[model samples]
Target: MAAIYQVDSFTKLPFSGNPAGVYISDVEQDYETCIKIAREMNLSETAFPVRTTDDNHYRLRWFTPTTEVPMCGHATLATSWVHFTELGIDGDIYYETLSGQLKVSRIGDDLKMDFPSELPFRIDLDQSIGEALDCNGMAYYSTGTRKLLFEISDRKKLEGLHPDFSKMEKLSVGVPLRGLIVTCKGDGEFDFFSRYFAPWVGINEDPVTGSAHTVLGPFWSERLGKDKLRAYQASQRGGEIRLEILDGNRISIIGNAVTVIRGQMLV
Candidate 1:
């Protein structure tokens, strides 16, 4: 039997964050087995801790319902919670992942993570993106994700968007990554807020994506004048990250994780 741990990462509340399942094992598990478990769990993402390197560090991997991914932030937070809170695992933890080493620390009730920043580049977006979205936007950029980031005038127009998913899928054929539509001036405490949709990655929408903040935190932190600011992901079940931009290459994102479900499964 494998122990299954459900953790809500990047938020303080239970039903208002990105929920991930963490499975811990004493032995190394195959990729196919991990993918099968992820598909069965049917969450946006699942994490597997294959080994404990020391009291404070472990090796981890993340998988979506559709495929195994290189990196996952929210799941990393969730995994840290399972280690420190549930299983009595403690101290500063280091995760060796496909994207490299990730350092996580415990701060009172919240977990803080120092993640690498992915500074976005200005790229040319094709007309197909606009056509597929069925909206006329002024600017577009790509972050190597399937989604093209679209610039718009106001929140009203931004919120009124109803993308043609079928059209988007068809237009995605020469596209770098899925498409993301964002506009400034939304009605929120944070200077800006965003909604993420990546049907191309097999997730139609992510409740609260910590990875997206790699781009977002830097972009907003520069624009908003303060290194520390509040970020709200406007989803049906939303989440928050207290972000602090450090220098140019590093950023600190803070949030809390709650353990929702814990059980063991036959593998």
Candidate 2:
């Protein structure tokens, strides 16, 4: 049996943010077991944290319903929330992940995650992809994570996007990446607005993605000419993120999470 918690990350209210499964245990589960658990949970991502040599440090791994990923922001925030609120652990917590060492700390009511920034490089916008996204002539870029990022001029266009998931999946197959980020300039309270789609990774649309903002922070910083910005993910279940660009290609992502469900997974 394993303790499983369903947490809503990136929002203070429930059902408005990304929900992730967090599994906390002293023993590290096998790869197949983790995959199975993730499949059973069937969320966008599930996190497994196992204790390491240091009490404050742990090894973290993230999994989608279909595959494992190197990094995941919402799930990591959920993990930290579980540790802080459920397990009575506080202060800074370190995680060893495939993306390398990461840190999360509590600042007031929000948990601030120190993540490596990913600056995007310009790429030619493909016509087929534009057609699939229903927006053409959008600027396209790629990051080290291999996710495709594009920008639209109108926030309404970005919000009204109804991408063809099947077309997106076919186009992304065998491309070493599955996620696409579509962003636009914000209107009122937000500096920018965006959405994420990753049909190839078994997620059609992520409600609020923290990992995507690692690239967005730098990409928008250069365009908006600000080091700190507030972003909004315009999904059906909307969420917000506070971003701060740091030196050495690092970014601080700040958001709030709430544990919505707690149960024991009997396996």
In lDDT terms, which candidate is top? Answer: 2
* Residue 37, candidate 1: alpha-carbon lDDT: 93
- Number of clashes recorded per candidate: 7, 0
For model 1, how does the per-residue alpha-carbon lDDT over 125-206 read when each residue is reduced to its tens digit? 5466668656665444535333355555555555566777767666644446643645454355766676676777678778
The 10 consecutive residues of candidate 1 with the worst lDDT sum are 138-147
Residues 1-267, model 2: lDDT tens digits? 889999999999988899999997888988899999999998999999998999789999999988889889999999999998999887799999998899999988899999998888766656767888888645455556768888878788888899998888777323467589999988769999999998878899999999999999999999989999999999999999999999999999999999899999988
Over 4 Å off, model 1 = 136-147, 172-175, 178-188
What lDDT would each prediction earn against the true structure? Answer: 0.75, 0.90
Question: Model 2: runs farther than 4 Å from truth?
Answer: 172-175
lDDT of 2: 0.90
